[model samples]
Target chain A: MSVLVYTENWNGKFKKLSFELASYASRLAEMLNMDPIAVSIGQVDRDELEKLAGYGIKKMIAIENDALKQFDTQTYTKVIADIASRESAKLLVLANNNAGKSLAPRLSVRLKAAVASGVGQLPEKLSPFVIKKRVFSGNALAGLELRTETKIITLAQNSFDLIEKPADMVIEKAEADLAGIAPKTSIKDVQIQTGKLLLSDAEIVVSGGRGMKSPDNWGPIEELAGLLNGATACSRPVSDEGWRPHEEHTGQTGKIIAPNLYFAIGISGATQHLAGISASKYIVAINNDKDAPIFEAAQYGIVGDATKVLPKLVEALRKAKSA
Target chain B: MNILVCISQVPDTTTKVKFTDNNTRLDTTGIQWVINPWDELSLTRALELKDDASSGVAKVSVALVGPVSTEPTIRKALAIGADDAYRVDTEALDAYQVAAQLAEVVKAGSFDIILCGIESSDYNGSNVGGMLAEFLNYPSVSGISNLDVKDGQVQVSREIDGGKEMIALPTPFVGIVQKGIAKEPRIAAMRGIMMARKKPIQIVESAPVEPLSQTLAFEPPQPRPACNFIDPDNPEQLITLLQNEAKVI
Candidate 1:
C-alpha cells in the first residue's frame, strides 16, 4: 500500500498547493513506511511534474485527454478513485481548497474511507491514527482518530511546514477513457480577479472592519496591503454590507487564513472573526476603543481613529520598505 | 420544487469553548445555543425561493439530526418560513454518520433539490453535503454564492481561486452554499413565531450507522502574548517595532 497525493494545476501551471501536498504526502508516507505517489489530471508541464522529485515523490502519473482540459468534479473523482483502487492507496492527501473540499468528500464515500477535512496537524500516533484540528472557530482543538481501514485527509493551508529532499522520481502516463458518463455541470464563464495576492498564499494581510465606516474609504486599506505586498480582507459585516466581496471576508463563515502578520484596522475582534485569524504569528490592532476584544488577541494595540492613523502608517511603512 | 435544507444548532460564538466528561464531551453549562450562521443563510435563501413563484419552488423542508433539545431551534426555523420540519432522533455523531442519516431521509422523500451550508460553525468538517451527494448519486456543487432555477435546471456561481465560475446542472442536485447566497437572515416575527407553533414537525427514526471517527479530547489554543500599547502620535515608532521587534517587515 502507498499514499497518493492529488496535485492541482491551474491554466497549465502548478500551484503552490501542489508542492505543499507533495511535501505532506512524503512525510506521511515515511511515517507509514510506504512510498508516496502523485496523481495529476489534465495538462501540466512534464518539467513541472519532474520538479516534484525535490519534494520526495517517488512516482508520478499524469492523465491527459482533450476532454480533461476543464475541471469536472465527477470525471476527476472517477479517475482518482480508479487510481487509488489500482494502487491500494492507504492514505489520500489533498489541500483543503476549493477543488479539494468538493472532491475529498465524494472520494471518501466512494472508497468507504474515514474523511477529515481542514486537518491542522500530522498524525500524533499511528496506531490509532490520531490527528488534531481547529474547532469552534479556532477557539478550541479536537483530537480525532479515524476508525476505517483507509483514510482521506485535506490539510489546511499554511498549516504544515514544507521540507525538501531530492529523490529519483519516475513519470508515467496513464490510460483513461471518459466515453461512459456525461458530466452534469459545465463552466459557462469564468471571471478571474487579477493583480491581488490570493488569501491562501499571502504572508501578510491588512484587514478592515465596520469602523472603516464606508466602502469609499477602502482606498487606504488597499494601498496599505499593496505597499506591504500583502492581501486585503474585511470582517463579515463589511462583506454583508456590500462594502467588499464575500471572497475577501475573513471570519468563521468565510475563509480561514494563517499569515505571518495580520493587521486589524478598526476591528473589534468578534469571536467568529478571531476564529479565522488565530493562526497569524503576530497581530496588530488599531482601533479607537482600548477595550476592544481585538486588543486581547493582538500583540500590539494603537487606540486611534483608522482614518487618521492609516495614512500616516502607510507613509511610514512605504519609507521603511524602501530604505 | 421540494427543497430540503439541512441545519445544526451550535454554541453561541461568544461563549468560551470548554469540555467536560474528561474532555470528551463539549461543556454546555452556561452556553447559549443558536442556529449555525451558515445554515441560517441557506434557510433564508430556500425560503426566498419558495415564496417567489417564478423560482418553481413549491415546498421548503428543514431537517436536523439531533435530539429533542434541537426542537426549539427547529421551531425557530419554521418560524422563519419553512413549510415543514424533520427531526431525526439521534445525536450528530460525525460527518460520515450525519451524511448517512441525512441521505436516508432524502432517499425516502421525493426531493428535487438539497441545500446546506458549506460547513458548520463548530466542527467545520465541510464534508457532509458532498458525501450526501455521493450516497444519493447526484451532482454536487459547493461554495456556491449565487443560484438561479429555470426550466428544471440550476444555474450557479461558485468561488474559485482568484475568481468565480458559473455552472449549470439539471434537477436532483446538491448545493453547498456560503455567505453570498442571500442577504442577512430574517428574524422570526411574532406572528410567524405564533404560527410556527401549529406547523407539522415529523420525527423520523435515525438510520443506524457507526461513526468513522471519534474525538479523543478538546484543548484550548495557546493564549496570546501580552500586548504593548503604542503611542498613536508616533506612527514611526510602531513601524520600527514591526521591523525590529516583530521582524515581520
Candidate 2:
C-alpha cells in the first residue's frame, strides 16, 4: 500500500504548500510503513516533479492532458480517484486550501473514504488513525478517529513544517481516459488579482479596525504593510462601513488567514475577529486602550495611539532593514 | 425554481468554548444558540434571489439535520424569509452523516438550486456541500462569492489563488457560499417573526448512514502568554522585540 499525496501546481510551478503536503504525507507514510507516492496532474516539468524527492516521495505520476488544464472539480476528482484505485493508496493527502477543499469532499464520497478536513497536526496515534483538528473557528480543537479503512486527510496550511528526507525518485508519464467524461461547469471568464499580495497567501498581514477613526487615516497602515511586504486587511466593521473591500475583512464571516505575523493596528479584537486570526503565529497589537481584548491575544502590544506609533515604527523598521 | 439553503445552529460567536462530560461534549449550560453566520448569509442570499421577480426564483427553503431542540434556530431561518424548513430528526454527528441525511431531503424535494455555507463556525468541517453533491450526483461550485440567476440560468463567481473564475452551469447544483454571497445577513422584523410561527416545518426521519468518523475529545486552545508591553515613548523598542524576541519580522 502507498500513501498518495496530490501536489498541485500553479502554472507548472509548485508552491510551498505542495512541499508541505508531501512532507506531511511522507511522515504519515513512515508511520504506516507504506511508500510515499506523489501525483501531479498539470504541466509540471520533470525537475519540478523531482523536488518531491527531498520530502521522501519515491515515485511521481505526471499526467499532462489538454482537457485537464483548467482544473474542473469533477474531472480532477475522477482523475485522482482513478489514480488512487490503481495505486492501491490506503491514505490520500491534500492541502486544505480552496482547491483541496473543493476536491477532498467529492473524492471522499467517490472513494467511500472517511475524510477529516482542516487537520492541524500529525496523527496523535496511528493504530486507530486518531488526528487532531481545529474546531469552533480555531477557538478549540477536536480529536477525531477515522473508522473506515480508506482515509482522506487535508492538511491545514503552515501547520506542518517541511522536513527533508532525501530519496531517489522516478517520474512516470500517464494518460487519463477522458472519453466519457465532460466538465459539468464551463468557465466563462477569469480575472486574476495582480500586483498585490493576497491576504490568504501572505506571510505578514497588517490589519486595521474601527480605531483607525477614518478611512483617510489609512496612509500609515498601508505604508507599514508596504514596508513589510505584507498584505492589508481590516475588521468586519471596517468592511461594512465601506472603509475597505469585503475581501480584506478577516474575521469569522470573512476570510480566515494564518499569517506568520499579524499586526492588529487600531483594532479592538472582538471574539469574531479573533476567531479568524487566532491561527496567526505572532500577533502584535497597537491600541490606545490598554485593556483592549486584542492585547490579551497578542504576544506583544503597545498601549498608544496607532497614528502616533505607526510612523515611528515604520521608520525604525526602515533603519533596521538598512543596517 | 425552488432553492434550498442548508443551515446549521451553532453557539453564538462570543460564547466561551467549554467542554463537558470529560471533554467529550460541548457544555450546554447558559450557551446561546444561533444560526451559523455563514449559513445565515446563505439563507439571506437565497431569499434575495427569491425576492427579485425577474430572477425566476419561486421559493426559498431551509434544511437542517438536528434534533427538536434546534427548532428555534430553524424558526429564525424561517423568519429571515425562507418559505419553509426541513429538520432531519437526528443530532448532527459528522460531516458524512449530515451530508447523507441532507442528501435524502434534497432527493425528496428535488430543488433546483442548493446553497450551503463554506463551513460552519463550530466544527469548521468545510465538507458537507461537496459530499452532499456527490451523494446526489450533482455538480457543485465551492467558494462562491457572487451568485445570480437570470431567466432561470445560474451564474456564479469564486476566487481562486490570485484570480476569480466565473462559471456558468445548469440548475440542480450545489453552491458553497462564502462571505460575499450577501452584503449582510437580513434581520427579521416583528411581522416576519410573527408570520414565521405559521410557516410549516417538516421533520424528516434520519437516514441509516453510519458516521465514518467520531470525535474522541475536545480541548480549548492553549492560553496565550501575557502580552509584553513596550513603552509608547520608545517606539523603536517594539521593533527590537520583534527582531530579537519574537523574530517574526
**Model 2 stretches astray by more than 4 angstroms:** A319-323, B231-249
The true-versus-predicted C-alpha distance at residue A221 of model 2, in Å, is 2.7
Candidate 1 residue lDDT tens string, A121-157 = 7898988988888888788888989888899999876
Candidate whose lDDT is highest:
2
Question: What interface RMSD do all candidates show, one decimal each?
Answer: 2.3, 1.9
lDDT per model, in order?
0.86, 0.90
TM-score of each: 0.94, 0.96
Docking class of 1: medium
lDDT of 2 by residue, B171-227 (tens): 899999888878989999998999999999999999899998999999888899999
Q: Model 2 over residues A272-301: C-alpha lDDT tens digits?
A: 999999988899999999999999999999
- Recovered native contacts in candidate 1, as a fraction? 0.77
Over the true interface residues, superposed, what is the Cα RMSD of model 1?
2.3
- The local lDDT score (0 to 100) that residue A9 gets in candidate 1 is 80
Give the TM-score of chain A in candidate 2.
0.94
Please list the residue runs of candidate 1 whose C-alpha ends up more than 4 Å from where it truly belongs after superposition. A196-204, A299-303, A319-323, B227-249
